[model samples]
Each structure stands twice: as C-alpha cells, then as structure tokens.
Target: MAIAGALIWAAVIGTLIYATRERRRVQSEHAAGLLILWGGAIIPALLLGLLLGYALWLMPDIRPWSAPGEPAGLRIEVEGEQFWWRVRYHPADGPPVDAANEIRLPVGERVEFTLTSSDVIHSFWIPVLGGKMDMIPGRTNRLTLRAAKTGTYRGPCTEFCGTSHALMAFSVVVMEPDAFRDWLADEARPSPGAGAPGGELFIANGCPACHTVRGTEATGAVGPDLSHVGSRETLAAGIMPVDVEAIASFISKPDAIKPGAQMPAFGMLPEADIAAIAAYLEGLK
Candidate 1:
C-alpha cells in the first residue's frame, strides 16, 4: 500500500509538472491531482481495515457459557494452595482422585474444571489451549476446555499468590480416553505392601490433622486433600516430582522447598518413620 501511494504521488507530481510546461487546463490538472491523492489515502485505509477485521475473526471467542460439543462429562477440581495447584479428578461413582502440580485429561473430550483456593487468591492458565480463571477462597470458578490434540500443555499461576508464585506451574496431560481410564484405575489401587503401614503412620505422625482422605479416618481439611496422592505427578505445590524421594524431601523439610508453605517441617521424624509415611502416601493411587 505504501508503495502504491508513493507511486501515485509521484505520478501526480509528474503530471502537474507536465501540465504546467504544456499549458494544460488548470481544472484538468487539479482534478487529476485530487484523484491521485484520494486514491492513495483510501487504498491503504481499506487494506488496514481488512487486516484488523481478519485478526479479530481469527481470535478465539470466550463466552461465559460453554461452547458447543465441548466436553462436559469430565469434571476436575483444582485447588490452589500458596503457590501450587492441587488437582482432583471426579470419577463416575466413587471419590475424586487427588494429584498435585499435574492434571490429566482424556484427549478429544471436553473437560470442565472447578477452581477453588485453600488460602489465598491464585489464577489458573493454560496459554496454548484455553483462558485463565481465578481460584478464590470460599468461592468456586468454572473453566471448560478440550484438547483437540493429544500432548502435554504447560500452565502457570496467572495471579500473584505469594513469595513462590513465580515457581507455580502445572501440566495438562491429554491422553487417549482408554489410556486415561487405565491410568485412573491404576491410581485407585492401594500401594503394594505399603499402603496400610503408610496410612497408620500418616495418622500417628499428625498428617491426618490437616489433610483429608475420603473413605478413611483422615478427615482434616486444613491442607490439600490426599485421598489420591499416588496419582499426582508432582508434590510440594509443583516444586518436586511425586516420587518417593521428593515426598521424603518435602515431608522432612517443606520450608526449604517452598519458603512460605503453611505445612510445618517434620524433620524430627526418624528415618524409618519418614520412609513409612512416604511409602503410605505413594500407595494413595
């Protein structure tokens, strides 16, 4: 457009010069110059308008209501704690499966999320696939999203929750529907040879006073619910992997991993008790 405008301007100047030398009528020269100037200005304006319109059309429209054909059958609960996301998957007839720092969803299914906060305000965001929603205490917000394709999507806290908010992040795993079901089934099983021992220690060590595990005696809700801890990918508010070593480290020293974490350090536990507690949590699939 700029090039066209410049060419038209040059042509008008050249025509005026020629008309002056050849003694052409003033009206004819004036009409030609006006036509060129108007054309030059109008063309670019039209092109710019078209470009902006196209961009607006391409952007996704987020409505307060869910979109058509979007998955509504799958519901997940996400609880924000300090700087981490505690995820829970609702099964058809049983208790919800608990996880931290990672969320798993079936590919090609519309998944709805119920967002809440244990303490402060936080935001949940997955940039590549969906919008951001707030996790407010004593209130629940809903966000519905579907993965058209299968892959891992990274998300982070969109709100400034606390000192370690910068490190708050979670992953969305979109798997085949059948695979997701299998994973859930696996997570439902008690940890082989260690679940009972761990459950006993969890209560004896005072973990049950704050955390809750439905269908069990640990009914405390002061912290993130742990009914399905084994299913989670990471722990400590997304600070470490949900593995034996990471659980041990978090149980031993939480402040070291997350400075402002509300959970106190249990470093005084004997190495054997710590191992037993870690083993029990690992069984909460």
Candidate 2:
C-alpha cells in the first residue's frame, strides 16, 4: 500500500511539473475534461476499488472460523478483568487447565480463543499473531490465530479498561509442539507446593477464599488460579518479574501496586508469614 501511494504521488508530481512548464501549451477544454474525468475520478476510483477488493479477499485468511459442527482442536477461554487476565485451556483430549497472565501456544498449530470481559471492555492483542479483538462485557468473541515462530512475545490490553490498564499485559510463549504438550500436561496437574508450609500459611490467612491451588484444600473462585502461577514468566499480569519478592510485595499490597485492583491488601500480615507464603507459591513451579 505504501509503494502504491508513493507511485501515485510521483505521477501527480510529474503531471504537475509538465503542466507548469514554461513552453507548455494551454490544453483545450476537451483535453482538460478528459484529464479530470480519468485522472481525477476514474483512476482513483479504480485504485480504491482494487484495494477494497484485495482486503475482502484476505478477510477469511485473517479471521477464519471453524466450520459448523466442527469443534476447535484447542480452545482457550480468556476473561478480562479490571487489571488482569483469567486463562483456561481446553484441549481436545484433556480437561481444562486454568492459568493466569501468561499464554502458551505450539508452533504451527491453529488455536482458537474465546474472549470475554467480567467488568468492562478490553481488547486482546498480539501484534505478531494478527489484529486485536475486543472483549466486551456479557458478550463473547472468538479469535483464531496460528503461531509460526518459537519465541516469547508480549500482549497488552489495547483497549483502555481501567486505572491499571497500562499494567494489564500478558506473555505469549510459543514452543515446539512436543514441549508444549509436555508443559500442558504438567500444567493440568496440581501445584508441587500444594502442601508445603507456605501452603499451610496460605490457607491459614484466608488466601484460599480468593485463589485456588490444586491438589490441596485452597480452592476459591474470586481470583486467578495459582495452581501453576510460579511457572509463569511474569507476575501480576506481566507487571513484575516472577520471583518470591515480587509475589510477596503484590500479596502484601495489591491495591498499592495496582490501583483499582479487586484484591485487598495484606500488608498487615506478619512479615514471616508473608515470606513463607511467597516461597510456597514460588515452589509451585
């Protein structure tokens, strides 16, 4: 498109220079009418029509949907919250795997995403994959994409949703098919830290009321799943590095770190208990 525009600009300049030449003859009314009719109107109309037609031809490839009665091989449901993301992976042959903040895909596989919002509107965007899709409250949207590369990419909330919109981002990890399958299988199981000392403290402090860690008694639905949070590349929806200190800081003062976050602050908790909980959560990986 840029090349086309530049070529048209050059043609216009060439014409202008020719018309303004000192030895140029004044064209007849008939010649002027023909120039206006073709160059001014018909040529531009043809160019725009061609561009529109080309875009229409590419729409299906860009946003292809599955055929009726044909289920997607892998469907991921992602719910957008005020300042975070809730992710659930549904494989064709396995149970749903709940995750948060980070998304993983296998190279060369077409994955379908079911997007929605819990509070306000948000836009799910991964520029390397394709265009952005909106996640609207009370409405579901589907976006299909295929990853051809193996690397880590970043996706952010393109639509302004709230105070922490800028902080709401996720990491996309594209891996080889075999590695992805192994990772997904491991992700489907309970966290390794489910029964550690920190896990006990996590339960004692009413953390289970909002978070869930499989293979243990900490099962709550108000917040993102922490079953494998330690395995994720980033913390707090990609705002902080995935480390014990970052986890402890967010746990102690979520509201201070992310304004408008729904999770209440736990800064008043004992420092030892907080550190233990962070260590336990980190061990989940």
Candidate 3:
C-alpha cells in the first residue's frame, strides 16, 4: 500500500510540475496529442498492468486441505453463523474439540482453516494473520496461515451478513508451541465436575438440544460448545467481556445483545434461574 501510494503521488506531482513548466514550451498541437498518448495513456497503463500482474502472481493460496487424512499441519474447521464463529479442532486421538469465537494457535506453525457458512456468505479475515477467505453456504473454502509472532489478532467477519454483522468478531491468540499444546490438551477435555445450577438447568431446560457441554449429558452440536465458555475472554462474538453477569444477560436476551442473532431470547426464564445458569457456566474453566 505504501508503495502504491508513493507511486500515485509521484505521478500526480510530476504531472503538475510538467504541466505548469512545459505547457509553454510545447508549441505544436501534435506534440500535445503525442504527450497525452505516451504520458497520459501508455505510461499509466503499463504501470497499472504491471501492478495487476504482480497481484495475480501473488494471489493468496486457498486450497481446502481440511479433508480427512490430509496435510500434516494442524487443521481447523470454522463455521460462520449470523453473529458468531463455531470452531472445531480436529484431534487424532479423540472427538473434535468444539469452541466458539476465539481460537488459540501455536506460533510459527502452519494452520489451515477450512471455512464454511451455515446460513449466509461471510468472509473470514484476520488481517495480521493472513488474507481473507469467503465462507459460503454449501461450499467450503480454505486459507492457510502462518503467524510469525505471539500475540492476539482480531478476526472479524468482513462480508455483510446481517444486522449483527458489524459485531461479529473474534480473537486469535498465538502462543508458544508448548503452551499451545497444553492449551489444546486442556480444551480437548470435558467440562470438569458437575455443573450444579447451570448443568441441570442447561439439561432440563432444553438448552442441550443446541449446545454441548462436554462430559455432561448436554452434548448437542447445533450451537457453540459451552464446555469451556466461561474461559473465553469475550461473550457473544466480542460484544462484551465474559462474565457471569454478561452470560446471564446474554442467555435471557440474546436478541438485545446481538440484533440479528440466531439464538432465541430466553426472556421467559426467571432472573434467578438465569443467574444460576450463568454462574454455572462461569465456573466451567
């Protein structure tokens, strides 16, 4: 971008200087026409054509390698929903680890993302990590990324999905290799202990039909997994900080937090019950 900007400014400034200084020197009408052809048309065309050719040569490599028994690198599947990201880490030894919104990857490793959409076309973009890839419904797209540094990067849904598209965002946390392995191991485990309030409520209140809290009987795969939901930094696709209060509010009023969210508002539940559910979810970590 800086190079392009410099070239554009250089062209504009050179034209301005030449027009003011050389206008009087060019006496013949034919010279002006020739100048317009070579300077105005030919030069800019060649410059732009070269830029286009370079971009085409450097187009982001997007080949879906998330299929079974493929690509020796770490593979992840991401499903784009209306206002959130459903993530799955394919592990060799056990069931796929289910997560939402945030992803933790090891630094200096090639990570392949298999992107798809459940409802609408959404673009997955983590600017500092790699190029953008579209997630189209019924179609799978892919992007291979390599993060050089260890830090948190923003992942936002670039394609305009719906009313809540602007709020659809996540975080990519790059950690050391050993740290990431430990984290992934931790993530693959089931929810620890019995969720007294939220566990029973989540099961009996029909929440299990859509969400999965591993280790318990709430193993529904329709929505984001809540096995480690309390450990996330943000709730509702980075809309708010993760806390028991926010979780309780989001549980009862998802529509209020995300205008076009798919989760139906559980406004009918009593405030105490909602708090209990939130408290239980908050302790999963």
User: Highest TM-score, which number?
Assistant: 2
Report clash pairs, candidate 3: none
Please give the range of 10 consecutive residues that has the lowest summed lDDT in model 3. Answer: 58-67
Look at candidate 3 and tell me the lDDT of residue 22: 42
- Candidate 1 TM-score versus the reference: 0.71
lDDT of 2 by residue, 1-285 (tens): 899999999999999998889975788999999999999999999999999999999777557576789766788999999889999999999899998899999999889899999999999999998899999999999988899899999999999998999999999999999999999999989867677778888998999999989998878988989999888999999899989999999999998899999999999999999999999999998
Q: Candidate 1 regions off by >4 Å?
A: 1-71, 90-98, 185-196, 213-216, 283-285
Q: Give the runs in model 3 whose Cα sits over 4 Å from its true position.
A: 1-4, 21-24, 27-71, 91-95, 193-197
lDDT of 1 by residue, 1-285 (tens): 578568868977986777679655566778877866775677668867887886677444333355588544768889988867777789765667765678888887767788999889999998877879999999999887877888877888989988889778887778999999988776555334334666787888898898876556787867776767766666665556788777888899888888787889999999888987887787776
Q: Rank the candidates by TM-score, best first.
A: 2, 3, 1
Model 1 scores a C-alpha lDDT of 0.77
lDDT of 3 by residue, 83-162 (tens): 89999987545567789999888899778888999999999999997779999999988788878899987889999999
Clashes within 3 Å, all models in order: 3, 0, 0
| Candidate lDDT (C-alpha), each | 0.77, 0.91, 0.84
Q: How do all models score by TM-score? A: 0.71, 0.89, 0.83
Query: Pairing residues by index, what is the TM-score of model 3?
Result: 0.83
lDDT of 2: 0.91
Write the candidate numbers in order of decreasing lDDT.
Answer: 2, 3, 1
